[model samples]
Target: MKMQKTNKWILIYGVIAALLIALHYVLQLSVFEVWNEYVPFLEKLSMSLFLIALIFMVSKIIRKLINTRAHLEGDRYNLLRITRLLAIVSSLIVATSFLFQNLYAAVVSFGLISLIIGFALQAPITSFIAWIYLIFRRPYLVGDRIQINGLRGDVVEINYLDTTMLECSGDYLVNDRRSGRIIRFPNSLILKEEVINYSGPDFPFIWNETPIQVAYTSDLEFVEECLLAATNRDFREHYRHFAAHEWEEWEPAVYFRINTYAWMEAVISYPVEPRDTTGRRNRILRYALALLNEAPDKVQFPEGTLR
Candidate 1:
């Protein structure tokens, strides 16, 4: 429905542009001498409007075609931004041409103006260049969770000069949950700092571990079995895609480590999506504890001060 409405508006703009161009020729019979001065304005207006509408129509068609392929969804956002920038540039060109009688003179004047503005807005110009870099290099996409500088968030918008993110695990939260805070940083920051994209490269899931403490008297074999069982069950129930232990080193592992206290730590490590880390840890801990508690004599846990 939104696409249809946008197409309708584009059609209206095209029709009005055509009528305006036709009216320029019809104005020769307006009989009013004052109307002669408005002919040039109408001509430029019609041309600019027609060009903008045409660009939008082509972009819309391209996006509609892209919508058929699920993999190209990320590219659609980049294309939309480029189309908007193109429209703004085309309108400026038309407006400037109408302002000067000689096209060369207009070009020279705009060049000088741009040079001055470039000097005045060095940071913003660098950010715009970085935006172009982002379109091609794609260190992170719109929906990818990334960490750059000191900010960690999910990319929501990448504008010409700045990128906006929905912050996660901010000052208010200890877990890997969204903090409902908006973070905006200059696009140029990517050039100066490293960007860590959770969704990119080869591995789709990050390695996370949850550790449980057990007394020295606990049955080490039983504890390992219980942890592995809990991990396998969680994988089968929640992440069936990883049920097979054939995907490189993504399979779950149970390892023992001596803690600073008298109790030993049995840690279960598994691969999980970045967004599901907290929940996955919780589920694995709950399941592992349940299985261990069923046989308290076999798997002893620390009590009192040692716990």
Candidate 2:
């Protein structure tokens, strides 16, 4: 398999080299003829050699740019920076080529050829442009948990064609939340889909819930107080900043209700860092249980309840 792959690559490279050589010779025969009268063969050769050298140099720079872009995985900022740099370099080259009228005319005449090439790569170019917008606007960032067009994941990379992710939720495996599978999402989706950023600048914390049940016979007010106290103790420091921020707009509160089914419902509502939600919920549950254990008889479940 490895040998076959190596041979295939060699064949492709050979074909490309042959094409480039053919193009160089064809251009030399056709274009250099006009200039041969004004410039000696040696000088023309030197100029031809320089143009060839420039093309190779540009090719090398393009390869490096592509490789550098590959490293910008999940980082929108770096991706945009690399893209802008490439655009600038490409523009400069095109502009410089225009300085030579004959060459410029020749290049312009080849616009149909360029158009054909552009048409062939329309999808990738469109995706790249969307990527540029994503980078500048920063709808999401690396490590941000987001749901876009029904796909949920932690973004792992942002590339030319697609953004890669470590899947978090959706139709995929449940409880295998830490599954190492990587997903590549096309950049074009940014234009077509609604992207929900779970960890955007404004809302870094997710609203978490910890539900507790107690007997209807328990002192309702007292259970509420105990539950609130437990929640405040376990998550106060963690949620304090967001709470304070929320307070500016609306008061933060933990809601409790006695369901019609004769169960005291203590729903501890709080904001938690999206990534730490699972662990934070566990801690809050443990604290709440400890608080309940202190008042065992008082906190007993309704008699005959299987739960």
Compared with the true structure, all predictions reach lDDT values of 0.82, 0.65
Point out the worst 10-residue segment of candidate 2 by lDDT.
244-253
Worst 10 residues of 1 by lDDT: 65-74
lDDT of 2 by residue, 67-135 (tens): 455553445345545644665555445444544444566476567556887899988888888877877
Tell me the deviation in Å of residue 17 in model 1.
2.8
Runs with alpha carbons beyond 4 Å of true place in candidate 1: 25-45, 66-73, 240-246
Clashes of each: 0, 2
List CA RMSD, all candidates.
Answer: 2.7, 9.0
Could you give candidate 1's per-residue lDDT for residues 27-79 as a string of tens digits?
A: 55656457678766665666656665665666555555544453644576787
* Candidate 2 colliding pairs: 74-157, 74-158
Measured against the true structure, the TM-scores of the candidates, in listed sequence, are: 0.88, 0.64
